[model samples]
Target chain A: MSTVTKVSSRYERDKELFLRYAAIIESSDDAIVGKTLEGIITDWNPGAQRVFGYSPDEVIGKSVLILFPPERMEEEMDILGRVAKGERVENYETVRVRKDGKRIDMSVTVSPIRDSSGRIVGASKIARDITESKLLHASVLEAERHFRETLDHMLEGCQIIGFDFRYLYINDAAATHGRHSKKALLGRKMMEAYPGIEETEMFAFLRKCMENRIAQRLENRFDYGDGTFSWFNLSMEPVPEGTFILSVDITNEKKLQVELEKHRDHLQEIVNERTAQLQEANRELESFSYSVSHDLRAPLRHINGFVELLQKKLPSSIDKECLRYLHVISSASSEMGHLIDKLLDFSRVNRASINKSDVDVGSLVRQVIASLAEEAPGRSVDWQVEKLPDVYGDQAMLRQVFINLLSNALKYTGTRTTAKIKVRSISGKGEDIFVVEDNGVGFDMRYVSKLFGVFQRLHSNDEFEGTGIGLANVRRIIERHGGRTWAEGKVNEGASFYFSIPRFIEQRG
Target chain B: MITRLGRILLADDSRNDVELMLLALGHFNLANEVDVVRDGAEAVDYLYRGGKYAERGGQNPALMLLDLKMPKVNGIEVLRTVKNDPLLQTIPVVVLTSSREESDMVSSYELGANAFVVKPVDFHEFIESVKNLGFFWAIVNEPPPVSRNGGEQLEG
Candidate 1:
């Protein structure tokens, strides 16, 4: 309890604390060293030996410059200059060299060591190897570059906006699609850059997505004030800061859709107008058929009837000339009547409702040939009929077609002593083409165009007695069944009539 | 040699058609029993014993040859009236006309017409058809007895 005894005990306690601090520094994982203001190594701990690869004896009197790499030698001086001025250099990251001559990244802290008199003597430095953290930082910077490059090369327009509606980032596509430069858009308000975008539906959708933290998609047309417009499909999603947007150009597709709709409307209008006109024409044709069947035939019957009465009343009193005149009148009236009947048949082919069924073409042709044979009893005609395929059409209309064609064949072949008619069928494009060829007095090829015209006759009545409406009737009937009729002939050689009908495919239920 | 069974009623609007029909009937000496009316109204009156022949008729005609196209009423209307009447329905109604329209033929059949014949444009064919019709209706086919009290009469 004396004053001197107390001071000596305090001194012993201070030495005990210093030894404990020394033990702690020696067991640390970091390097701890004591050096002088002149940059000489004074003390080195076990951690310093482990990090610098040097033992305490090897580095106790060496200059600290031995641990500095040649390129970082000035770093030691700069650190020492600050430490000698009683300033602590904290986290002075630089490169250093090991005893084995390998270099490593290090983070160092240097503090001015003080004596018992409070005067700076040397410095105590702590260092840590930071090579892993340095490599991690470099990799992080490389990934950021890759992400920016990927955004720049995307085809779809991408843009990132801040909460203040300013463009934080705009990809290359977004800048080009918006018809503006990236330099002009970045860090600029979106409304200021596009001017009219604030009033657009795309802007509204983007704002809604941002406010509600949701995603939205919209299509809008941007009119450029010049006569040009562009359509865009915009997809917007709420991000952390504001909204992220992706835009795709759909101008061409939208234009094509609009044009197709317009064409469809135009076609519908044309079909309606054509149907109305066809209905009107059918009404007129019906009235014409009615008049021809009744009023016209009545007059002709009266003419023939009166002539017959005149002949019956005064057969013996009538002179030969008068009788001959009466015969002409009667024959002419009968001819007119025949013409009217054939005309009505032709018109009926147009007006009648087509009842479709499978028709046997071969049997129909045979029946027609037999009727023609009965009409021309004395003619020696050789008929060659092929095995015809069944067709789907109106049976009666097809029968009429065959009747007219066969009758024409029999009549034209009257000049030949042995008339030969060949009936055959060949398959055509999507149809069956039936040919009726005859070795007859063929018509001139110049008048072939008029063959299917009503009242158009090639030969005079004296040569071949006909009303000249048979082929016309044949054409009308075939046309009603969605078929076509045509002829091929040469003068005095032979003639062939050809008609085509669509092939029928069986329908499945 | 033609039997005078019953009166034949001929309804035609065309004068020439009527004259021809009369001549055709005269060929068989059956014209005396035949009575001609100008239009369908007269035909209806003659059958009903109204208008002109109310006092002159003995009984309803045995056969009526109705022309389709007439001025006041058509052949179809006259056929409809006669076929619906129980008293007059026994008479055989034949439609003879210039029209060969399918609608006319279908309507005639639907209205219970006994026969439909188109007048031929050929005079000889017309005469032959008329002769056959007159001979068959007047001489071959039996006629119903006269209805005297506007009631259906059982035929003997």
Candidate 2:
């Protein structure tokens, strides 16, 4: 009876130890599960309920295969069969589904739970949820792959150098720029690859960028020492390793710039030579003009003077026809003399250096009209002068232009009973165009091209008196002021002469 | 006889020019007192009382009519000599030439020429111009007294 009582107390102590172990298993953070050898769930703790989103009552008799993905169902069989055969599976990683259908990456450790007979009947598994840590690891690997892809496909030469002047990473373009293979260049010092690289201009820039942690740029010619050189535009920025370099080749563009500069210099030489020749010709023209003025007029003066003396001396003895012939001779000589003076004036207009200033053309027109008052009384001349802008030009020359144009307008309109002359000007882009329109005897359009030529006249001397040098001088003065001249006319109807003066002159040294 | 004017100097190269000038001035009988020289050298000699004028014995002729483009010396040189000299500078100088060049006019005026007259090719205008200047200078205008130093006198 005493032996029976002692065995009962020991049995009670064993029951208490079993209850404490069960309580520790219920509160474990990891899911602790129990299953039969047939892959059916036998026991599920509170940890299992929290991990799989299921209660113990719901999965106590359920098939453990439900927790496996359909594609990995065979994994359950293999793992459980190994456990039944008494093999311990520790930290086996696999994919499993929760009750809410969210998949998780898990680390599982399985052991055989045997009966007292030392035979495996069920398996005890402890699993850890590793989804967040696994995703973080995968994303880091993805970022590394993306960085390699971006640097490998770049067209500009991109390279990263380490602290010892070694190539840590080099792309395909960087490899081609150095004329070396990427496999042979990486992890190798640039000085070892290219023998004299340290002495190069680009090397100094790279060294400075590495030491000072500052960025630098260079368009330098790198000589490969085989009598061949290439121009490179290199940019270097300090990086955590050593230096990051980017380079683009511009050898052809530099060559084109050199060629263009040489061509422009050659063109300048030609322009200088041509200008010298033109100056020489102008000097000759000046001397010729001087000769015409001094030598040619003296004889004509003598001829006219003697003719006048002959007329005065032989007045009573000479017949009327003879006196008339004498008169014609005198007139012809003076006319020729007048022509010489006009020719000299035309020549001098081109040769004289222009004095440019702001000139009020309206006042100049009024002054010319006042001078023309001597030619005033014969005809009823109606002049309509518009308000004109002040133009930059030689006042005396521009005054001569108005003198010629206005006088021609007045003279050519001699036949009109009521002469109407209008001096109108309109502002244009970078210029002002002035029109001297008149209701006068206009010229034939067929002969209009000859209007501004020296000694070119449209009307006979009996019809209208002109030396024809007036329009030519006008054209010369306008052209010298950076302007142009043209005209429109119809025979016996009217004529409109147009001349333009620039509002602004482009400065030249 | 009330002689109206003093002797006037006429310097020209061409004999025809001298004849025409005489013809123009002879209308009013003003040619009687005009002393003609064939070139600028003789004109200079007559004014300086040297060379052919070594026997000259009168105040430098009443006026000098200088012609440009002479053979030996030019009107500009002759004018330079007369206007630069103290004794001859008092006489008036007129440049009567065939050249209407602006440069010639500028040089003449710059050299202290009293008047510049471009001889007209028209004989009637030539006669009118010569008559006007001749009448004004020889008769109407009076000459400075025989004072050697007649430039701008320093004011006290």
Which candidate leads the pack in TM-score? 2
TM-score, every prediction: 0.68, 0.71
Candidate 2 DockQ, CA atoms: 0.63
Candidate 2: where are CA atoms >4 Å away? A1-106, A111-123, A128-136, A273-288, A305-326, A351-361, A377-394, A415-450, A478-509, B1-119, B123-156
Q: What TM-score, to 2 decimals, does candidate 2 have? A: 0.71
Candidate 2 residue pairs in backbone clash: none
Highest DockQ model number:
1
Q: Give the poorly placed runs of model 1, Cα more than 4 Å off.
A: A1-267, A506-509, B1-7, B27-37, B40-61, B77-91, B143-156
After aligning candidate 1 to the native by TM-score, how far in Å is the CA of A476 from where it should be? 2.7
What are the per-candidate TM-scores when only chain A is compared?
Answer: 0.64, 0.78
Pick out the ten consecutive residues of candidate 2 chain B with the lowest summed lDDT: B147-156
**Each model's lDDT:** 0.87, 0.88
- The share of true interface contacts that also appear in candidate 1 amounts to 0.92
Cα displacement (angstroms), candidate 1, residue A503, comes to: 2.8
